[model samples]
Target: MVRAAGKHTSARLVLICVGLLGIALIADFLWASSSSSRFALIGANWAPPVSLLTPITIPNKGVDSQKNNTTTGRVLSATFADLPAPELKWEKMAAAPVPRLDGAAMQIKNLLYVFAGYGTIDYVHSHVDIYNFSDNTWGGRFDMPKEMAHSHLGMVTDGRYIYIVNGQYGPQCRGPTSHTFTLDTETKKWQNMPPLPVPRYAPATQLWRGRLHVMGGSKENRHTPAVDHWSLAVKDGKALEKEWRTEVPIPKGGPHRASIVYNDRLYVMGGQEGDFMAKPGSPIFKCSRRNEVVYGDVYMLDDEMKWKVLPPMPKPDSHIEFAWALVDNSVIIVGGTTEKHPITKKMVLVGEMFQFNFDTLNWSVIGKLPFRVKTTLVGFWKGWLYFTSGQRDKGPEDPAPKKVIGELWRTKLNLGS
Candidate 1:
């Protein structure tokens, strides 16, 4: 009886072990099937089959659209889709004729025109340089009617002519001017147009519907701000001899903001309300107080002629003095400075790049540049972005020399579906 009982106990133990193994196998098979189906649904439309058990490591070639061949029997149908993202390729082009900062650049046909700003040795300049895309060369140097240099000057083009509006000229921000000029690309001549109603520096300006609209800037030195908006009335398809008519003012006008017209709507972004810089030994500078207010608010002018505030920009503190250009319904903003440092009181340069989609109302970071930059001349032409001379560092003081950049950079913009 004892032997029979012992044998019965052993049999029962073997049966329990087999039952656990069968249960585990069933659970694993069910999990694998579900995972494979989910991945197939997500990736079958675009990517090849893959296995979930095998890890995927994307190579550093360019984009992640290539397929992975590693597989496991349990997860044979798992795969990943190629996401829609911007593919960028940056290359160094020919250097500019002169090194400068805070200049304006515009593109017409196959030519890129760059206007005056602060040169490396001079406080201001009236020089103009042209880049020919056909030959990939820089030539056609001309001079403006007067010296123009400031942190923020408004410039636009209508394919035949380039218009420049109010800006400052001096070693310091002491000479705010209301002067406006237009350059005839065919004649290579600068002609005086109606000046702005108010003398301001860094006012946002754009050309829309046969009229030039100007708004917001520093009124009289970089201390006081202006919120006025004016549009030049067109006569006989020309803006000559036309007076500026007052329109709806911007809700929160500031200096050095970027203004652009896209799809018949005006959009403005990034500026400061107060003095951007203070004297090195001043109380505000020494104490490292946040005297200047950098804004990240984005405003748009609708068809009704009313200003509608859009979603605020991301990374508000570091959105000042960046260069902006529109490419295929997307707004691209590159490189700017952050607020003053608490201890050193110096502004920090941010090298981040971002793109805003108009249809989706979303902002995404594209990539960082090779170096930090601000007040750079940027324009998009024929699927390539041209960035010219700009300042890599703040202006020098006393014995130190100013560091101006002279290289031209070109990048191919690849939009993926």
Candidate 2:
């Protein structure tokens, strides 16, 4: 498990415990192996003296047709599923065209905006796509002028605009670029935003109280994932045209691009800084390195944006493609590749999902991914959590972007409680 004040792991149902400040709530999943549940949300929590909301799981068996939902300038597949028992309905908001590992997404209103990602494609893509759930249609696509790809790009949305933070151009998979961009939801346009003080890939970005904060990513010189934390005002998009000024640094280790906003703070999860070189389309394949993944740690920013490393990820796996979500009211980190196995040298798919709580800094267990999500973008919508599209490559024998999934799956949280 991630962390709990009491240090117990058998928490399936959540509870509230009275504490000094006020109260806190806790919960967990009594997950069973034979579970084939649909996207559902249930009212559950831990009453360990504090009170909080926790989402319980219910199995589902319904399915929907795989349809395409274009989100602006990006190519993605969207689908829908209704969990009957729980009466929860959801639509697949957005997806990346192919197996784009280490990709990211931003949500605004009914649409989900997807940004740069890398995979089988030879060149880095700076394209941005948005998906509208209301009309089940994709808006026009926009390009990220910078040659962007391969980054664990941290993403954030102000319910009106989407912003991109630190990412580097790599010669390994595709290449790297030192740039930042933001999408204006109203204008449906992308404007060059402020650039980071340093050029790094896979740093985390989040929004709180109208300000944008960026932390962690690998610089060209391979400095320990930039521990610096920077903040800027998102005043009428003018900030994009300038440079990113610096704030406080983490004062410890660095953070990866995999970040999530919970209870108003940015929880930056795993990622590492290394010398990576991809053949043509692969990113993070460093020279002299076995294409292995690193960074077994996790951390979060306080309301003040200060850094505090939390419990590391569940097991051990690394890939700029690694993704995280807040499913079932628990912070869930999922799929990415690792070069641990020689046969599948470049990358190997992961189905594991790790859940941790933002409050107690406690970690718990969760289910595996139901689909092959190689290039995944995580998000929450209408009471559900989503894993966007990704890809897989066959062993050298039939090596190609084997499975490019346009499928979208949701594990929603019941807001009825």
Candidate 3:
């Protein structure tokens, strides 16, 4: 994996120029779609503020020596180190082609699936990219079915199909689409699913047991994000063979990001209370001065759908979030900026990655991610966590400073008990 620190001096300039361009492009695409089945990208807030990118180089890693690193007979195990804590080096297995930033990624079997993300403010892409670990090739990109841009799209795999949920669409997220679609892994074909009840973006979804559980996100008409959760059971992927039912509300409040399933429970991290939180605006709606605060704090839900608080995160917190599965009952999360931005009055970038172990009920810092990107897809591939273009926007932080990293990064996760 790659690692690097940002030049604090150039950060402000990048925010304004890049952010404006992104906003303009999103507006242009919302009114149109590609002649092909392809779609356009929906940007997250302005742009991912000053991404903390450490592009992990894959070939440089001695993949040949990895066989000895496997302590538990699990192939490709990783040892995480806190930059300064230990000399724990992450061995890169493979890499992604056309390095895309602020895009979405999902791992099914050894295949990593990538989708929509903003290449720049005015340049949202609807390319469907994929990477196969078994073959180590990154081609096989199919076009998305609609013009859906704006980051923070909820993604989950129902063990059979991959689902892309709602986010901002049409002219910088001016008009919204309750549109839902699924990707047939076998045929690589796109099929539309039922639209969300309310058009919302940056919502959280969990694939548990046999259900696709969707949590709160910012609403279209109202500024308030919801705490109400919906559960869908897929029979053949047409309609929700089973309807949506309510699950537990976020203990702290409504509108949460990064709702992931681990050890029979759903865990959520930082997120703000506003539409397209990736842009500039006040993120506090259902929040208290404290809890409303973008929190690094972690919360949990049991199989019974009960809520409980775990350990709090190492602060300055974030408003957006992404999650992936890990060893044991653990899960890993990346990105989400501080509770507030340094200049534009919006949360810029935190460049933080963390992991939660269900058995231990503990949180640990993994490693710093590369700069200049948001998380669209953060999934497990082989034994490493593969991250793709991740972007989103909430309030009015426009030109919506936007940034897109045209690359992919991977790191090894130490999934030991």
Candidate 4:
């Protein structure tokens, strides 16, 4: 009878232990879920800026390992206040008809127009897809006048007309073209515009004060960087004789620059100075080296028509082919790739974002991206920012197969919590 009583006690103890273990697992799951949600809330609110610091690991190199060293000599910091963070809503819309990378987008009224870009295969596409925001659906597809494939082509719009500027075409970094064309949104037709003075690609163009300003691209298939600046004005609404006038050139020009006009002044930032290919028979060429240069310099063209170099970015070798937009009078630079991975030595996509305050000339970490993206089309409409299709992953050199994304993502910009 004593043994039977002891067995009953042991069985009861076993049951209690099992119940305790189950409770512990449930508590752990709840904690993990809450922590993940908190992080998501933080990302949706504000991305804190993070500085990429290279610690001097070589022993006795006379460099302090504790100090964060970057090529720009600026330390990145985040100042988070106790104030409530902004609440953001993200929606996944209809995907594009075709997957593309290095595309441009322009929104006219309720319709969003996506232009030509490199497709999934070897060739570029001239397909034009339209998205109607009012109906929340993608409409019919249109074709460009010509079949041209150029990544990093400049595109801008002045409500009624969309301008397509110089870009590279054909296979393997072919020479840049001076082709410029404008599409009438009302008529659904394209009209040839005055050609650029110099052939280039990856130039940033903006419509400022009824004039189209084109500046800072690469010439000769990105072999040479050009600082040539030009502005085209339509005289008396006459499109036939539109004349492009020369403007003050940028102090330094490079490929894949992000340009925007804020407060009547032009701001250019983040581009590299080197070509993709090294000179023939060079030592670097013999080694098949790639991504030789990257830049993080920021410059502004003031109302006085003078270019002033601003403080360098905290992250050196940043903003190479990234997406940027002016939000709340601040420049928000999104995801782009760095030249080389710090650990793997492969090219890496920078998933973090930074914001530059025009008033104070300071930068802050805004937030992190859900995924890595580059050469994307960014559009701002109705208090929301849209990040469209782009290339994902680290490009061709990535150990895994790269993907050209077609997903359309939008996030509310100014929605208060």
Backbone clashes per model, in order?
0, 61, 65, 5
Q: What is the TM-score of each candidate against the true structure?
A: 0.71, 0.63, 0.65, 0.71
Tens-digit lDDT track of model 2 for 101-173? 4456765666666665655443344666666656555556777655444455656766676776656554334
Question: Which digits, one per residue and each the tens of the lDDT, describe model 4 over residues 196-259?
Answer: 8877777878777667888877776465678889988852222445568899988887677787
lDDT order, best first, reads 1, 4, 3, 2
By lDDT, is 1 or 2 better?
1
In candidate 1, stretches whose alpha carbon ends up further than 4 angstroms from where it belongs are 1-89, 147-151, 235-237, 276-290, 317-322, 393-402
Better model by lDDT: candidate 3 vs candidate 4: 4
lDDT values of the candidates?
A: 0.66, 0.52, 0.55, 0.65
- Which window of ten consecutive residues has the lowest lDDT sum in model 1? 73-82
Model 4 misplaced stretches (Cα beyond 4 Å): 1-90, 147-149, 235-243, 277-290, 314-322, 394-401, 414-417
Kindly provide the TM-score of model 3 when superposed on the true structure, using C-alpha atoms.
0.65
Question: Per-residue lDDT for 9-37 in model 3, tens only?
Answer: 46777898899999989876864444112
RMSD in angstroms, all models? 13.7, 16.0, 18.2, 15.9
Global local distance difference test of model 4? 0.65
Model 4, position 92, has a per-residue lDDT of: 83
Global local distance difference test of model 1: 0.66
Clash count for candidate 3 is 65
- As a TM-score, model 2 comes out at 0.63
